[model samples]
Target: MMEVPRDLFIPPDALEVFLDTFQGPLDLLLYLIRKHNLEVLDIPMAELTRQYMAYVEIMRANQLELAAEYLLMTALLIEIKSRMLLPRPIIRTNEDDLDPRAELMRRLLEYEQMKLAAQRLNDIPQVERDFTLVQVLIEQTVAKRLPEVNVDDLRNAWITLVVRAQVNRHHRVTRAELSVRSHMSRIMRDLRGREFIEFNELFGPSAGVAEVVVTFLALLELVKESLVEISQSQPIGIIYVKSTDFLTSV
Candidate 1:
């Protein structure tokens, strides 16, 4: 079994449904009239008073706090209902022949107009009510400040970075096959009959890094085998490459 706290103080009318819409009691009356399709000009006082009393009784049963104005309106409705019961003169007179609901109807019409006007005014969004007003403040100075970064800009930047990382992802390393033996044969053909060939002539201008490394290794192997000679005429002078066949002939 669950036990409630000793400090839990619930009010008698804590669970209350608020019916205070755009109009208060008048609005309730208007709603009843409209729902029943009763003409505002020729209101039936008996039915109106009965419905009003039923609502008042519900509020009373629920121990709802009532306003003096609500009680006054209730009394006025009863008086109108009673006046309707009173006998009228056989010969009709001005104002006396009018319905007892005339004054209440006049107020209801005026109240309805005001309510409609208020609703129209409420519908047209005003500052700080329906939407948040965005104001961009610009400060004037010799050194102008850069625009502030908003969440949307930051989010877009993050998305761009993710896309670029995916497109240019360097996760895989591919190994290319280059042969030093092939580069060696290429060098032998280039240095075939040359006594002194400029060092740069043996290498292509558009050689890739892998090809350049292979060519350098091939040149080193030729020099180790005493098949090619590399020489510089003077200090910091242009280097030259030559075959040992020329030196052997000399």
Candidate 2:
């Protein structure tokens, strides 16, 4: 008797197969109807609705989140079923009788068509190509001697630094985020009278350690942009600055 009981044991997780795949109760019902090649307009609501609730029970057994939409769709199906079961006076005419489920059928057909179209589109190849119309042309104008550094040149470099730092990977806490542009503007205002200053001294203690580090990076970018020049006195000494060959075009 004991051996027979052990031998007769059934697999525990057989119901998990159904629960894992269903989007919701409605999706399961729709799938079952389609699999059986049943017309949506003539849905045997009593049978289909029972099957839907069974799928929901399976979902509940698996402790999955039961969305309210599933329950709502079930109620709608039941209502449509009750409406279909009612008696109505037959009108003798050439025009065909209207279906109660016509609206639901139309929606289903449209949705199925869209789904098939999307699948077909996904099969097409994707190609990458540079698509741009506007070309950047650098015009060589008549050489007219002007001041070494303009007010706007330094301002734009500061703007670029702030934008880059905000988007940089190293940033974490927003509270810890310091604006390099804010400090740069302050430094520029302070260095208005002096034409050149030592790079490290320019980023001195008024700005915190993090701000100083970002400012150094900003200076490098400014140099690369030809907005400023960096010069060293010896092998490893303080760097000097001179106005660049090109002023900010932007």
What is the alpha-carbon lDDT of model 1 when measured against the actual structure? Answer: 0.70
Positional deviation of residue 215's Cα in model 2 after best superposition, in angstroms: 76
The superposed Cα distance between candidate 1 and the true structure at residue 186, in angstroms, equals 56
TM-scores for the candidates: 0.47, 0.38
Deviation (Å) of 60 in candidate 1: 0.3
Query: Residue 57 of model 2: what lDDT?
Result: 64
Q: lDDT tens string, model 1, 12-84?
A: 5562443333147887688678867888989998998888777767667667777677788899999999999
Pairs with steric clashes in candidate 1: none
lDDT of 2 by residue, 11-90 (tens): 56554444445555445566768866787768787777666667566567667666787778778777878877877658
C-alpha RMSD for every candidate? 23.0, 23.8
Candidate 2 residue pairs in clash (backbone atoms < 3 Å): none
Best by lDDT: 1
Clashes of each: 0, 0
